[model samples]
Target: MEVAQGLCGRGALVTGAGKGIGRAVAVALNRAGARVTALSQTKADLDSLEQECPGIQTLCVDLGDWEATEATLNTVGAVYLLVNNAAVALLQPFLEVTKEAFDRSFDVNLRAALHVSQIVARQMIARGVPGAIVNVSSQASQRALQDHTVYCATKCALDMLTKTMALELGPHQIRVNSVNPTVVMTDMGRLNWTEPQKVAAMTSRIPLGKFAEVDDVVNSILFLLSNQSAMTTGAMLPVDGGFLAC
Candidate 1:
């Protein structure tokens, strides 16, 4: 996936960069010449990523710890781009959902995004640098899935969070938006979607008759983060294979 020019040397931060979509985005940003800081709870993953992208910076933090996450991000310099891609999916039926599962999911998915964005945005305001933030929401946010009650709720809340951020941060020229993808073929996706019955159930509903690959979602993120979508903010860009259209 290719990103726009003029991003070189600009500071960018991506959370949950240890694996899946977040890892891909961090690498893409680095290749696009942005000075990237990749944050995740996994140190080994960070080490591997740093080796792959020699100049990339990586930070290890458990985003569930609100104070620690806040403190850790405060150490970073001004960020021109931020991707709140860290999330946890606690798959439980609606009636079986527990308070612990709900709290943990929200803390990681929604609350952490708010904290990181607040810090990054304040820095941008202080430095007077325009910034862009992309939150990785999901298709489940719009549609109710059988066992994704908590995950869906968090994403739905995240979409609203993105909009409110766009409304408030617009004056500062800091754009915020969400990229909602259908089942992505990441490792996690494969584990969850590879079963014949499950695959058929989902892909049948998608006009393209397929689940999304990591690159499909990555390309959409590049557009939203780059100047190509300069006028886009508070918009939900679906990287699904027209899955929502069904």
Candidate 2:
């Protein structure tokens, strides 16, 4: 019996690869032998990942910029995998949310994914290659939480986008899916969950009794990107610790 090959010889692009889950996913893919390209708006973060994972490529670009994203897509070959992990979370009351906050949230969380998918999927179709797209959504898409009006709205839109893209791209042998996780213990989560009481409060909601780890989400993304899930598409798998189930 032969071992299955890693994502070797494949080209993968992951957005928001500066840190957190995106960075974890990029490293995981790189270790699995994929020629990974990580994109981030912060050069330092990109550099750090590139340094940590030798031979991995880094691209510093704001996905919110439509023209730049379009141009970047042109340089990549038939994308074997694309992880739309770039997102901005603006937590504010519905009435207190500013227009700028709302627009920026939508731009990064929804519009950017749309722009990149259009460009990458076109190349995939033209090359007659099969690929997978994993959108890093959140549990907020299915449930409401306090002070998450704008953030929830954006993720909800992303969920819809994932579904529609899966439907449309399926004919072209492109699989589109989403991985929704609960509060991940990343830098952002640490900042937001710093208060002991707040941490306790949120932890109580998760049946798993703890916040999600970065590797938890990364594993799910890799699974979706692999051939094991070849027949899977249009699926929104929750990596959340039973957060939505409760």
Candidate 3:
């Protein structure tokens, strides 16, 4: 009998893979021997990633468009690991939030994740392969943040969806979970939290007294996708620096 090589020889898919946490996850998976299919809208980012990690397949698609996303999924082949990391944050105060902003936020963050999971999970079932899925959630999902009204709602819904997916997909040997991270110092993160007062306030709340590096979140994602988390399902692992604990 052939021994299972875990991620090796398996196919992996990551969305929003052009940069930030998604980029990190895609690179890590490829290094671990998985054939990676990276999806993102930015061509330059994808091209740069390909140069950095040879042999990674790239797909440029906007997951926010429902019809386009469905069409894109048809082109995807079998994948054993799926990371729903693509998300958009349109920060607006609750009172001033527009319909378009709300729809776009939910469409990409919540709707896209569900659609991709459905497509990937179906492929796993058809192949009779045990698989793992990790949704890149946010700490805002649990704790409310000012001006993040819509973003918070979508993530909160995603968290609940993860639990339901785990419940139903568990019978098929597919584990589903999410990682809720605090402020990760990616390009976008730094832009929002660059002010000294904002940074200090945020850090003071976290027990670690520092924001997450992209790799910090990436390592957590890798753990959830690997066999090391074989017995874990319906779990929401926090990659926060103890912010929620405070």
Give residue 230's error in model 3 in angstroms.
Answer: 0.3
* TM-scores of all predicted structures: 0.97, 0.95, 0.96
Q: Candidate 1, overall lDDT?
A: 0.92
Stretches of candidate 1 off by over 4 Å are none
Give stretches of model 3 more than 4 Å off: 1-5
* lDDT (10s digit) by residue, model 1, range 1-246: 235655678899999999999999999989888999999999999999989998889999999998899888888876899999999999998899999999999999999999999889999999988889999999988998999999999999999999999999999999999999999999988987768987898888999998899999888888889988888899999888897777
Number of clashes found in candidate 2: 0
Worst 10 residues of 2 by lDDT: 1-10
lDDT of each: 0.92, 0.88, 0.91
lDDT of 3 by residue, 8-127 (tens): 878999999998999989988898888999999999999999999988999999998888888988887789999999999899999999999998999999999999999999989988
Clashing pairs in 3: none
Query: What is the Å distance of residue 191 in model 1 from its true position?
Result: 2.4
